[model samples]
Each structure stands twice: as structure tokens, then as C-alpha cells.
Target: MSFYTSLNGLKNAQTDLGVISNNIANAETNGFKKSTVAFSDIIAGSAFTNPKLMLGIGATVEAINQNFAQGPVEQTGAALDLVVNGDGFFTTRSAISGDTLYTRNGAFEVDDNGYILRGGNRLQAFPTDAAGVVSGNTLQSVQVPPTNASGAQFAGVAVGKNGVITASYADGTNVAVGKIALATFLSPGGLRQEGSANWSATGLSGTATYGEPDSGFYGGILSGALERSNVDLSEEMVGLITAQRNFQANAKAIDTATQISQTIINLRT
Candidate 1:
């Protein structure tokens, strides 16, 4: 019993170590969120068993909760580099399946076809009217207008505080591309993590409510900057040390239990 209990403890520590290591590895990744391991104690008991005599079997991992706290902003001076100052996620779409994805990574680039993209995924925004006005409650791939019909020069991109993106031509004329819509969930923590710093909506997360930045529940957009990873190296290092100690202690406990069992077996023989 002691051996199995200690083995379980070791496995739980190993799981925690994996989570901490991942956080440390992504410490410099943009828009990365840190994760923490939660645990639950396992007790050996039956429905008819007395509570006073119930013994703890071991510990098990409950969940790996991710921390979505706002990371510090770094000024990159690049026009397309963006960050939200409050609560909201940038809406993006997978080019292959057109599946909607959300992320805090506002780093974007304009493709040769004038479509704004991140890792080949099109960034989504509300469509704009001819008067350079953004129409609400709709989403489309963000497109940058050419400075000229010839498509020779790159148009200047400007994102406003309210999430409106405008394309400035060389002729000093500004065309409203669209308003980059932000998505907010009732429970952001329930959002499922996808690779490449993206998250997908889940039933637990509820439906995402799309809105303009700085309006109602959405966050204000920060242009010319990016959100850094939320991982704290110091905290992660401390956690790693704790996990290592726990693993060692459990191993030692298992060895002690094994030796005691052997001694009892020899005495009986």
C-alpha cells in the first residue's frame, strides 16, 4: 500500500514538472499563457467504510489551469504589431477549413493579395461601407487597399483605439478597411487551447460575443505593440524545485517501504 501510494505521488510530481517545464520553455513566446497544475487526493475507501478509517491512497492531477492574466506590452514600432489593453481576443480564421480561432497574438502581416494574415490564417474584421465606415455585426477577412491600382507601394496600416483599421495611401488619403472585431467569452478560462497560441470556443466557454474594442465589454486595441508571454521565470523555477523535492521524497518513501517489506518477508521465512 505504501509503495503504491508513494508511486502515485511521484507520478503526480512528474505531471506537475511537465507543466512547469512547458511554461518555462514558452517564457519568451509572444501571447503565451502560463499553466498551473491542480491536484486532488485519492482516498481508499468503500461506501460502507467508516470515514475515520479511510486512508489516503495517493494524489492525482485534477486539472491544468492556464493563467490568462494580461502580459506586459512591448513596443515593437511595427505598424501591424498589436495588443489589447484589456479583455478581448483577436478573431482569426483558418484558411483551409474556415474554422474560427481566437488568439492574443496580434502580430499580423499583409499577404501579397492584400489580405491580412497570421501564419496563413486570415484575420477577421467587420466590413466597412464606401464612406470608410465600419458596419457592425459582421465579419470578413481583413483586406488592405492598395495605394494605387498598380499595387506598387505598401499602404500604411493604422489601427485606432476603437479597433478601426484604416489604410493610408501614398496620396494622403485614408480608406477605412474595417473595424477589427474583438471576441469575449463569459468564461474565458473555459476556452480550449489550440496550438500556435490560439484558443477555440467550447461549450464550457459559452458563445463568444463579438464587439468593437473599448466598447461595452471589449478591450481597447494597442497598435505598434505586442503582448509578451505571461510566464514568470522566477515563479516557474520555484515550482520546479518544489516538484523535484516532492519526487525525491516520494522515491525515498517507496524505497523505505520496499526495504521494510523485504525485512518482514525474511523474518517470516
Candidate 2:
């Protein structure tokens, strides 16, 4: 029984170490959020046993929760590099899966077809009228339309703080292409991580609530900037040290228990 309890402690310590190591590894990953391990004790007792005499068998992992605290924002001087100044995630559609994903990583680039992309995923936004007003709740892929026969060349693209995307032409004509859509959740920690700093809404997170940036509680977009990873190296290092000590202590306890068992066997012999 002692050995099993010690073994459980060892396993839990290893799990903590792995989580801390992952956080340290992704410290430089943009838009990365760190995770913390939670443990719950396993109480062993029969219904007839005295409540005060219940034995704690061991601990089990209860959860691994993500920390969604805001990370630092850095200026990248790239027009497509964006950061949410408050709260919200940029919505995107995966080309391969066709599943809607959300992310804080605003690093984006335009393809030859004039579609704004993050990897194979296309950025999603609300369609806008000629006056730049949001038209409806439906989301469309953000893109720069091809130059027309009128000879107006594609000049530049701009993303406003309010999440509006505008395309400029050499002919000095500007068009409101779309309003970038932001999604907020009732429980952000319940979101499922899809890697590449992307996340998908889960039943636990509830359905996404779409809104324009800089309006209401939605965060404003910061163009030419990006959000850094939220991992703190110093904090992770301390946690690593603590987990290592716990592992060592549990291992020693197991060794001591084995020695006691061997001595008892010798006495019986």
C-alpha cells in the first residue's frame, strides 16, 4: 500500500515536470499560453469505515488548465501582424478541415490570389457594405479583389483599429472589403487547442459570440504588432525544481518501503 501511494506521487511529479517543460519550450512561441496541472487526492474508505479514519490512497491528475492571461505585445512593423489589445480571438477557416478555428496569432500574409492567409487557413470576417458598415452575421474570407479592366492597380491594404479591412487602388479608390470578426467565449479555458496557436470552440466553452473589434467588450486590433507567449521562464523554472524534488522524495519513499518488506521476509525465513 505504501509502495502504491509512493508510486502515484512519482507519477504525479513526472506529469508536473512534463507540463513545466512544455511551457518552457514554448516560451518563445507567439500567442502561446502556459498550462498548469491540477491534482486531487484519492480517498480510500468503505461506507462502514469511520469518516475520520479514511486513508488517502494517492493523488490523481484532476485537470490541466490553460492560463489565458494576456501576453505582452510587440511591434513588428508588418501591416498584417496584429494583436488584440483587450479580449477576443481572430476567427479563421481551415482549408483542409473546413472547420472554423479561433486564434490570437495574427501573423498573416496574402497569397497570389489576394486571399489573406495564416498557413492554409483563410481569415474570416464579416462582409461590409460600400460604406464599411457590417452587413450581417455571416463570415466571409478576407481578400483583395482583382484589379478591374479600368486599370486601377492594387495599391495597398489596411486594417483599422475597429477591425475593418480596406483595399486601396492606384486610382485612389478605396473599398471596404470586410470587417474582421472577433469571437468571445463564456469560458475561454474550455476551448480546445488546435495547435499552431489556434483553438476550436467546445461544448464546455459554449458557442462563440461574434462581434466587431473595438466595439463593446471586444478588443481593438493593433496592426503592425503581435502578442508574445505568456510563459514566464523564471516561474516555470521554480516549478521545475519543486517537481524534481517531489519525484526524488517519492522515489526514496518507495526504496525505503522495499527495504522494510525485504527485512520482514528475512525474519519469516
* Winner by TM-score: 2
lDDT of 1 by residue, 32-53 (tens): 8999999999987789999999
Error of 1 at 206 (Å): 1.8
Best by lDDT: 2
Error of 2 at 246 (Å): 1.1
The 10 consecutive residues of candidate 2 with the worst lDDT sum are 142-151
Model 2: residue 183 alpha-carbon error in angstroms: 0.7
TM-score of 2: 0.97
Q: Rate the local accuracy (lDDT) of all candidates.
A: 0.89, 0.92
Which segments of model 1 are wrong by more than 4 Å?
Answer: 130-132, 147-154
| Native-referenced Cα lDDT, model 2 | 0.92
What is the lDDT for 269 in model 2? 100
Give each model a TM-score: 0.95, 0.97
Candidate 1 to truth, TM:
0.95
